[model samples]
Target: MPVSPTYRPEPRFFDLGGEYGDPVRAADFPETRLRFRNDRAAATVGLETLTDAEWIAHFGRFVPLPGQPGPVAMRYHGHQFRHYNPDLGDGRGFLAGQLRDDEGRLLDLGTKGSGTTPWSRTADGRLTLKGGVREVLAAEMLEAQGVPTSRAFSLIETGEALQRGDEPSPTRSAVLVRLSHSHIRFGTFQRAAYFGRPDMVEALVEHSRSLYHPDLAEGDVPGFMRAVVEASARLTARWVAAGFVHGVLNTDNLNVTGESFDYGPWRFLPYYEPGFTAAYFDQTGLYAFARQPEAVFWALTQLGGALKLIADAEALTEALNGFGPAYIRELRAAFLSRLGVKSLGEAADQRLLDTTLALLREGGEAMRWEPLFHDWFGGFASSARALSGPRATLYQSKVFADFRFSLFDHEPDRPERLEAAPFARPEPEEMVIDEVETIWAAIDGGDDWTPFHEKIARLRAMGAARNPTESP
Candidate 1:
């Protein structure tokens, strides 16, 4: 990694004082080996001054930054799978540091599996190295796909073996650093509500708004709801269009900034099945691919309930009601963006979008998510050669006729880029369960990172091509 001249540290989150959390210490590990360091993200906050050894020490040892306060595990309560869980808080993680980036946004440096706090309960507060690796891949892929998400800023393998039932026993342990916009979750407010501390809830709203929603009116919970609702809608739409199932939509996981983070049991659809779920335990399909929008809306409603102490109930309800329409509009735009097609106005665009999804749905279990957009990305003209490939017979079906007609209404976006070589590959990049296991297998068996690194390269390339330059 090249060192830049702009290495500075700012710890603004500590200025919030002790109301949000209690001070916690990082666990002492036997050793720390640097596994991943996000150069782009590090440069954004000017953290390159720290050597790799220093980086591991700072992240691994939980040492306070220069002139910074003690690290705190934030206090909050959340609904887990629809049931209110008052015991919930940051169990294995805590906000370690904060900084101001080049873009002038306040970013947080938080740790996962660093050690246990008051909420650790009976569980061991250690992270598997494999889990750390998975989070790195998840954050990178999601960010590349344009989802507002937290980045895995650093990953370091701790020299310890931890036993767990989910995977093989005695898995290698590690600690991860995540850089994100805010750590204030919806449950942050809910915690205040649970304690009947409306004043604290209002204080949190003011604090977060002054940082993230500076333009909005002060102490206006309804206005805050509108901003959060729009952002959440955009985020949920991104997940759906990207064929992502977050698996856990627990209230605690839904941060107020609407960015996706804390990846566990996350999966990209192998096929465009609405019922597909990432978590094996999600047998009831509560957080399935298709129901993600509904889940987000429900979470927003819960947030609205929490704000009833300060905001007008009717106005909050009105803001919450906007989610359905906002979700529809955002979902359409997200799908359009994924298809790399220029919108020909709402009616025609909706027709194109509907037809495309209809075809995917009709293709059923046989149709994969990425390839449909990958193959016919910019419509028939762009995918002519790809249509000649093995899956040609599937697209040749009568189910695609409307989608074919909708193509006449608009031109392909950046046709020149589509004409360039990379999009013509036989297969689109996918991140399903099997591929995840394959990457982990390479790491487990041979200590090789070739496949993992190459996968990131490919996903980054796909992101460059798939992301739209023109705003919707």
Candidate 2:
């Protein structure tokens, strides 16, 4: 592996001190087997130069990166499934450190399954290998869909066995590292307000604004609210357009940065069914596919309330109110983008979008999600050969007349990608539960990582077709 000539580490979160987090060391595991390495991400932090041994030493052994003293176990509280839980915090993970990327943005390398901390409580702070593998797949698939997401930076197998009710007992264990814009969550702000500490809320907000939304003026909490609200709205819309159901939208699970992370029980809809629920425990379908937009808005509202402690009440309220329209607008654009069409105008675009949705519904229960867009991906320009199975009939029906007519007026976005050889295949890569479980079974049976690695490679190709350019 190639390495960077110089190492650039920026350790700043510790500056906030004891009020925000506690200094903690990672658990000493008996062995470290590097299963995955994100060289693309590693290069950004000037860590590409690391020898495998050094990589294990710093990331695996939990030795602090050279310039940093130690990892800080962050403290924050939030509402879990609508109930405020003050005891919640980072029990098994910690913010390893921050580093400046090529674009000059500070990125955090957060760890999961590192060890137990004060917040670990009665549980052992270890992550199941299955859990770690699922997160990698989820993040990769989401990024392939052009959603703003944290990168699965690394996965290191720990020489330990763990028992869990979710899977067979004595399952393998691993640690996951995620490279993300900010670990500052909606709960991070909620923790301050939970204790009736307005001053602390103000401090956290200021520190966060400077790190990510520095364009906003100091103490401009209103400006910051609008930015986060807008980002979150767009993020939610993208999730909807991508047919992604984030099983848990709890306040603590949702990041204030609006970048999706901490994947658990996430599922991509195989069809356009709104009733699709990912997590089996979600009895009421609280976070079902169709209800996702509403769930995110609720989370954003909670975040707004937390920010209200420092930002102006009127401004915060207004900003919170903007989520609805922002969501609709972003949804339209994201959906259109996914369909590989350029928007003609707001009215025409909305008409095409509305008609498309109607077709998906009226097309019968057999309508699969991806094929709708994948079939008519570049709008009316695509041949009928592009579609197969049940959806193939819907386009021939009267319901699709308006959709077809409206699509012709708009130019297809980067339609050249469709001509790529992959389109010649019967289907694009999909991340349904069955496929995810199959991949996990291979790993569990014989430590076979080929399926996982190949899936990522295929996903990267799909991403190139969606957005040829890389995002920061």
Candidate 3:
């Protein structure tokens, strides 16, 4: 394999000992077909130099990278849909390797549907091809929306048929490799505490703090908890601003790095409906679009509870209490960023956000979420442009009057962005369920990848237009 000079492999998780994970082998599939490869993410870890065959040999064949450890199925217990499940762990995937990016930040190369582990229970640990495609789209869209999320590094179709109750039986299978900051989840600490292993809890805390939150002092459990709370709050706020519904908010899915991953039944909102849910199984709407903040806070509390084994109860409670205020603060910031406007102080920003939400709620089904922000991206600066746009009639309605007035009070952050090619289009790049199904249909029916690839290109172009300084 041709390795880049900047390649820096660091098998840090392997140092946590056998109790934290189990060494595992990937499944031998009948076929290895590459579906997607994120060269941008690869460049971060110095793996962009590899040829396609070499990339498959490493990622698909599960050949250990130079100076990297083999796949290790991580151990943890999590609360699934508010129910504590001790059997939960890396049932289908493993932490394949770790490496430092160009910025010296540690990143984990984790797999999904690679093979079964000891925690596989009674099911086959393989992912449906549709599931893999959906995840790639979800990750890309979230990233483009400026949400902190895991990048879909590589996706390879494996020649196998798997039965799934959620979809039609005998679905195609694939393996996904996700690039994320850390694989250490809130459940990691919970597992340690559940076992009455205070030492392990302390070790986990130190490991997380040192690797992910290096700003904290040694063994600063309270500070570490506070950092995680703030990061989680920011993540939730971004999701809200992006109108993303992460169907599952389990403790195992929420990681220490606060990057959103493990997309099962995620969806982007068509409008501002609070009760909208992505998963059909979510009959109770526990993880609804509007309830995401509460869900994340609950997950954080579970993490805090696990940390209570080693830290003081008062300190943990104090950290937990910061969630509400932090969420509000980050929400304001996130909304302002998405609206492409400068803040007019906290009070004014709050009013603008309140008015914006009210307008959306009142607009009901008639108003699409992304277009509102897209059309008025530069706030009052783009008024002339928006007024003559397709949704101009709705914008001129009485219900939108307050939001319009409030928006005018703020200055545009990057007014030049309105002149970009993406904004010139009638509609913004959206990943609605209908469009997602359409893209999937192209591949499922005739194996035509043109739509899928074209959608990705358009998405990347939109991302680049929105964030001109960023590398796609």
Q: Sort all candidates by lDDT, best to worst.
A: 3, 2, 1
Model 2 regions lying over 4 Å from their true place: 1-7, 384-391, 470-472
* TM, every model: 0.95, 0.95, 0.99
- In model 3, where is the ten-residue run with the lowest total lDDT? 463-472
Model 3 TM-score? 0.99
Worst 10 residues of 1 by lDDT: 1-10
The best candidate in terms of TM-score: 3
What tens-digit string does per-residue lDDT give for candidate 3 at 65-157? 999879999999999999999998899999999999999999999999998999899879899999999999999998888899999999999
The list of candidate 1 runs beyond 4 A from truth reads 1-10, 419-421, 467-472
Please give, for residues 1-472, the per-residue lDDT of candidate 1 as tens digits. 4234554456665566677788889888998888888776787887766788778767888777654676789998998889999998889999897777888888888889888898898867789999998898888778767778999999988988999889897888999999998999999999999999888888889888988898898877889999999999999999988888898998999987899988688988888788989888888999999999999999998899999989899999999999998988988888877777788888888898788889889998778887887787776566566568767888777778778788666777777758544587878878878898999999888989899888877777777666544111
Residue 393 deviation, candidate 2, in Å?
3.8
Better of 2 and 3 by TM-score: 3
